[model samples]
Target chain A: MNTSENMKARLVDYIEAFNAADASRVVALFADNASVEDPVGTPLKEGKSEIETFYTYATTVGARLELMAPPRGSHGNSASISFRVHITGQDGRPAHIDVTDVMDFDAAGKILRMRAYWGADDYHVLADAS
Target chain B: MNTSENMKARLVDYIEAFNAADASRVVALFADNASVEDPVGTPLKEGKSEIETFYTYATTVGARLELMAPPRGSHGNSASISFRVHITGQDGRPAHIDVTDVMDFDAAGKILRMRAYWGADDYHVLADAS
Candidate 1:
């Protein structure tokens, strides 16, 4: 089992890499056969190829993540983080989505699966968005 | 599908009920067939009977929960909350455990499954504990 410290460190790296817009750095945290189901109900992006594409698009977008609290690690092969994703809404207004991501790690310390939890109502247009 | 508002409301209620030390109130939020996996790797407490027993002990232990972030809702039948469980350690010292709980709701808005994420290292004795 991966140590709690190691799992939490990786989660921190994910946030930093994403905020830096380094898609490669973000993708490198996942296993080759990893699966990502962002928003929990969405179709999964499977394998490194698809996962790479997903991160590329996500990183390129002007989205930034702000941690809501410290990352949490499980006794099992999982860890979780809660954050807000700031982005431009369809109407060109600044908005943020409240999200919690749970990641399951492999023996190699790479993310094997990631599921993000965020509902439609979680999106909020910033009051200052004009 | 349970509405996001309803899901989030119940999560709030759960915290309130727990803090109130009202085990019955907390148990009422769960489905008849609900299953609870506290701390991920632990054996599950299945069904309302087992779940009720689990919460009864939890609530009676003088453990208090402090939310680290707002409850998060998913597009599907799930919601999550990150919190700190404040309690007395085995040595009778003040301690806390950082935990993230994910709940899957049934169509009727009752929690069908609940999983808590926390590792052994997540439990920490307060600095003031001497």
Candidate 2:
């Protein structure tokens, strides 16, 4: 099992790598066969190849993450982070999505599965967006 | 599946009920066969009876929950909340545990499963606690 410290550290690294737009860096943290179920009800993104493609687009989109609290680690091989994803809304205005991501890690310290939680109502357009 | 609005409302109610030390109210929000894992990797308290016992003790202990962020809802029947649990530590000093709870709801809008994420290190003693 991965140590809690290790799991928490990796979660922080994930946010940093994603905000840097370094897709490869983000992908490297996952196991080759990791599965990602972003937004909970969506179909899974299985394996690194598909995972890489997903992150590549995500990172290129200019969305940035801002952590809401310290990352939490479980006594088990899981960790979670709550954050806001700043993005451009459909009307080309500034918006942010509230999200919480739970990740399970392998013995090798790579993420094995990741599930993100967010609903349509969680997206909010900035009131002062210019 | 329950709507996102309903799910989020229940999560908020959970916090309010727990803080009010109303164990029955908390248990009412759960299904008859609900399972609660207060800390991930710990044994689960299964069924409403066991869940009530668990919450009865938890609420009686004078612990209070403070939300760290707004509850997050998923596209599916799931929602999450990040919060701090204030309690008296082993040293008889005020401390807090950083926790993130992921709850899955049944079709009728009752919680079916709850998993709380918090490792040992997440428990912090307030430096100013007298």
Please give, for residues B7-125, the per-residue lDDT of candidate 1 as tens digits. Answer: 99899999999999999999999999999999887799999999999999999999999999878888788999999999998988899999999999999899999999988888999
For model 1, how does the per-residue alpha-carbon lDDT over A47-78 read when each residue is reduced to its tens digit? 99999999999989879999998888887899
What is the lDDT for B33 in model 2? 93
Model 1's alpha-carbon lDDT is: 0.92
TM-score (C-alpha, index-matched) for candidate 2? 0.98
Give the residue spans of candidate 2 off by over 4 A: B128-130
Candidate 2: C-alpha lDDT: 0.94
- With a 3 Å backbone cut-off (N, CA, C), the pairs that clash in candidate 2 are none
Runs with alpha carbons beyond 4 Å of true place in candidate 1: none
lDDT for each candidate structure: 0.92, 0.94
Q: Grade the docking of candidate 1.
A: high
Fnat for every candidate: 0.76, 0.76
